[model samples]
Target: MSESTGGTGEGTRAVRAGLPEPVKNEPTLPGPVFAAHFHLPGDVEGPYTYGRDENPTWTLLERAVSELEAPGRDDVQTL
Candidate 1:
């Protein structure tokens, strides 16, 4: 959400959004990406129900991508 989002280009957004964070209730810093499946109880409810729904895998992938690409101007040691 920005006042100038209307005219911003893809590259602008890519550089402006900064970077994403890792999500999980575990001690893992960066995890693996898996198309997981889930099962729920009839007397219970769950946020995710399918592999494509949402899982730790997607979160791990997102964080990995962000971290791998999150290099500041000075981070470029050479080239």
Candidate 2:
């Protein structure tokens, strides 16, 4: 356990910490999302524009890595 990883060991933090909470009948890890563009009816500006740029899956991974690097802290930006 390490302070940087919220008291979880490096392996556990690398594998599970900051990941989306598991639900019954759902996989522990989310699968990759495949799409070029989503239906944008109203606003043209948003976090997701194209798959090449960013998506929800990537967002989760980013947050997980950030937490592993600096657990229990919000001031640091990992992305």
Candidate 3:
């Protein structure tokens, strides 16, 4: 595909995308965030206010899977 869309190869993009940037003395991959409930201390105006609704970890995984399924494309919907 194009370099702008997902850089070089499928294997490279699949493993690199949807992951946190490398940091000094930090794990390459981050741990999962699990929570059945969250403290709504203020106005609920963020992407994550409930666990059941969505999870950051899951979102990243979904993106990675989508890229693997269809590279250089945006018409992807996961159930």
Best by TM-score: 2
Q: If candidate 2 were superposed on the true structure by all CA atoms, what would the RMSD be?
A: 3.7
Least accurate stretch of 10 residues (summed lDDT) in model 2? 1-10
Encode model 3's per-residue lDDT on 1-79: one tens digit a residue. Answer: 4354535665577677666568999988877676556565575576675566677877887777776677656678663
Q: Which has the better lDDT: candidate 1, or candidate 2?
A: 2
Off by over 4 Å in 2: 1-7, 37-47
- Model 2 lDDT, full chain set: 0.71
Q: Candidate 1: minimum summed lDDT over ten consecutive residues — where?
A: 70-79
Which lDDT values do the candidates have, in the order given? 0.46, 0.71, 0.68
List TM-score per model, in order.
Answer: 0.33, 0.62, 0.56
Residue 20 alpha-carbon offset, candidate 2, angstroms? 1.4
> Could you give candidate 2's per-residue lDDT for residues 19-47 as a string of tens digits?
87779999987777765766657877866
Best candidate (score: lDDT): 2
TM-score of 3: 0.56
